[model samples]
Target: MQNKTRYFIILLILVPVCFSADILLGSTHIPFSIFVDMLRGIEIDETWRIIITELRLPRAIVAVFVGIALPISGLLMQTFFRNPLADPYVLGISTGASLGVALFSLGGGLGMVAIISNFGFASSWGLIIAACLGALMVMLLVVTIAPKVYDTTSLLIIGIMLGSVTSAVVSVLQFFSNPNELHAFLMWTFGSFSGLGWTEIIIMACFIVPLLIISFTMQKPLNALLLGENYAQGLGVRISLLRFQIIIVASLLAGVVTAFTGPIGFIGIAVPHIARMVFKTTNHKTLIAASILIGCNLLLLCDMISQLPGFQSSLPINTVTAMFGAPIVIFVILKGRKSRLHYS
Candidate 1:
């Protein structure tokens, strides 16, 4: 109770501050003094305020959503696989979205056709839907085969195989692409938070917010999930149904972010570990909310740093995320191992 209350309070305070920080600490440092003055209706320079509110502010808001969606997806993936290392991208969703983008960029006439079909959302729709479908397909294959094969390793192998297939297809698309299209596609694949605007943010909010609400609401069943299928089933939880629910929410959350933001690394895999480390429990109720906050703040911080001082062009958001994510994941694994050993 104490911990949950703490997180709830922390979230309200932290989220707003982090949001403000992202607004203030970009390529040009807008001092808190200026930010506060602007907020309080002080007569600041009109140009700076417009730039902050219209441009930089939206990007910061988008980062908060990106942070929320990716980590929550990571949490769902870890729970689904019962593996500490599982991430949304590891299950082939990222690869699938990558493949979809590959098709858009490299397919020439086919790419044009796809776009014209309002399938043109490739820049967004194509990537997101492909990711969602691809994740579901992989999960479906794993669950269906799990009972028959009676081995978790088999499922892992199959997932890797799916990832490979997506990779190969992407490679083929790359080979024949024209230089201009390829360059455009490459730039997008690098990932950045600056691309999203109000329209995209509204679209993201409509989907991600409800999905998170559902994820938390279903936390009890998720906790039951850690005990193994039969154990959970014995507790009156329908394992298959529960897994399906989680996958649906996770896939959509992950796909939507990846679609808009490009394949962001580390957050989906590392954030849960951070949350679990802080909270020290498998109780999904607390774990889910805490993970969201930590993930949001961390990503916001990373986004701010990516737009570093004296770096005029800005580093890709994915690059910053991967840099942070790789170290965080390694730390999580070693700490998790030590924790398990101590418990044993």
Candidate 2:
């Protein structure tokens, strides 16, 4: 308990450090002294001010939230499915969001445009709504099917099949789309933290914060789940209800992030495992807190790297996260296999 508490405090302290670093180091360098002055309410260069406020600040904020959302969702999915490999991408939620965006942006249908415009949304808002609806559709489907399946593995396979189908649809839409629309859609898939501003952040917070609060309350039940479904059920945990809540929370968390950032890969799958290993416990209470803090730091670090500070060009946020996360996932799988071999 003491070590865990100490680790938590360390994580909390790193939050500001990572956030500050993320904001400070970017394509256009702002010296630490100037950054301090700006933070201290002293006037700074107008160009630097714009760079700090308009560019880096929003992306940093988005990175923090994306980091929190992905790992938490991954944690929930991993616990529910009892599979280390379970995540939004594995369960089709991210692909569903992608399908939604592709349908709206690349569908090239005037009817969809007319319908969205009637709601008084500009193009960006329409795209966001489309992604949300797409995710919601998949969530409903997954929830509806979850009860019918006898095994978690079967449910996981269903999710993969759904993702495959959505990917095919997205490909079809891309083929038929105009060159400009195709390019725009492709850029969105590359994933970014840069384009989002305050409005999008507020929207994400509204969904994420409430759901996150609700998730913390599930700690006891989630811990029960770690002991196995039979044991959890014996402990009076409502298996079906718990599964429903987990699916809903995980889908919405992943869906909202995907809508804003475009399917950030590997973070969802990798971060929860990182949290579990770091904490050395399956208790959701510690795991949840650890995942949130670690997720924020990791994503901010990835965002900083994606900016390619000394270069004129930046890599995609998704690319940097994948490079960081994929190896961790490989290590985890190899370690699991090695442990099994040792036991056998």
Candidate 3:
């Protein structure tokens, strides 16, 4: 308890530090004095304000929330399934997000205007709704049939097959899209933090804060389940009910992140493993905090790298995440390591 509490405090401090570094240390090299002045109500040139607020601020804010959402969702899924490889998006969440964007690119522009005007922010919720619904449909199908299958590996393979099918469909959409639309769509898929603004950032925050709170609330049940599903039920966990909560929370986390950031591939898988290595515990309480800290810091590192001039043009943000995320995932698999109880 003492160690978990100490680590949580450390993590809370780390988020602000990572965020400050991201805002202050960009390519233009605005010194700390000017950066402080700019943020502290001193008026600079319109260019600086515009650059800071319009471009960099949105990217930084979105980076933080997207950073929080994915890994936490991945953490929930991994715990629920007792399989380190299970990510919220592993069940076609990313594919559903891709197909939503693809369909919107073809028929309407982002579809934000259509969904809104009537629904307000609730309508503004469509991207996540599309993603959640798609993920839910897949989940429903899996649960319905998983009873007969008896083997968990088969369920996992079925999910992979579903993902492959969605990928193929997305490819077909890409094949027919015109050059400009194709370029736009391709850029979205590559995933840059450049385009989102304050409104989107606010919405991402609205969902993420609540979702994190819910995940914390479920920590006890999650810890019990870490002992395996049978043992969790012996401890009075209502298995079906808990599974539903985990799935919903995990899907919401993945859907919101995917909607705004495009399919960021590796954070969901890599950050949980990193957290496990850091905290050396299975308690979702501490693991959650560590995962959020590491996820935000790691993304900040990736974001800084994205702005580098080493490349003629910047590499996409998703590309950078995968470059780091993939190797860590492979290492975790090869090591075949697992979790440990945070408390007796």
Candidate 4:
């Protein structure tokens, strides 16, 4: 318990430091003193204030939220499926979102850009709505199939199949799309923490914050679920209803973030496992808190690395995350296999 408390305190301190570093590590570095002044609302150089408030601020805020949303959604999916490999990306939720964006941005032709220019509201909301619908469709499909599958392995296969199908469809769309639209879609696929403004941030908060609060209320049931469905039912938990709510919340969290920020990979699959490994507990309560803190810090660190000093152009957010997260995933698979072999 003393060790856990110490780790939590360390993580809490790391969050703000990471956040400030993310904001400060761009092309034009903002001095730490000026950053503090901007926070205090004391007037400084106008250029510095604009950089701090208008540009770096929103990116940092979105990075924090994406960090939080993906890990929690991953945790819920991992628990719900009882599969370490399950995540928004693995389960095809992110691809579903990418499909939505492709259909809206690629299939619709150059006229869609005109729509975005003419109607400022449709610029972001169109993609959000499209992505939500696509994600919901995939979630509904998965839920419909869940009862029929007897094992987690079969379900994981189905998820990979779903992702492949979506990718094929997106490839077709890309082939038919014009250069401008194709370029736009390609860049979005790279993923970004920038481009979202305060309004989009508020929209994301409206969906994510409430759902997260509701997830906390289910920790007791989630803990019971760790024992198995029959055991959870014996403990008076409503299995079907609980399953539905978890699916909806996880789907929406992944969909909304993907809609706004493109489909970020690996963070979802990697972070929850990191939380469990660090705390050495299966308890949802501790895992949830640990995932939030660790998720935020890890993603902020990724964001900073993506925009390293002296680089005029930043690396894609996905590139950096994959570099870190893919190795964690590989280690997990090997460890799981070794454990199974030992038990056998």
Instruction: State every prediction's TM-score relative to the real structure.
Output: 0.86, 0.93, 0.85, 0.92
lDDT of 1 by residue, 52-80 (tens): 98868988887888889989988887877
Worst 10 residues of 2 by lDDT: 114-123
| Candidate 3 per-residue lDDT over residues 1-344, each given as its tens digit | 68767776887787778776777666676567767888688988787778788877788888888778889998997887678888877767677777766655532333332322233221235544554555556566655655666445676677678878877877876776667666766776787776677887887888899999999899999999988779989999998778778877887788778777778888998999989887788788888878888888888778878877344466789889989999988888767744322211
- TM-score quality measure for candidate 1: 0.86
Give the candidates in order of TM-score, highest first.
Answer: 2, 4, 1, 3
lDDT of 2 by residue, 147-230 (tens): 999888899999999999989999988887778677878888989897777888899999999999989999999999887889
Report how far residue 269 has shifted in candidate 4, in Å: 0.9
lDDT of 4 by residue, 1-344 (tens): 58889899999999999999999889888899988887887889999877877878898888889988999999988887788888877678889988888888787663443333234322467766777777777877877876688665677788789988988988988887888777877878898988777898899899889988988998999999887778999999998888877877888888889888888999998999899888888899998889989999998999999889888888999999999899998988898897842111
lDDT of 1 at 201: 82
For all candidates in order, the CA lDDT equals 0.75, 0.87, 0.75, 0.84
After best superposition, candidate 1 residue 13: deviation in angstroms? 2.8
How far in Å is the alpha carbon of 138 misplaced in model 4? 1.8
Error of 2 at 80 (Å): 0.5
lDDT of 2: 0.87
Better of 2 and 4 by lDDT: 2
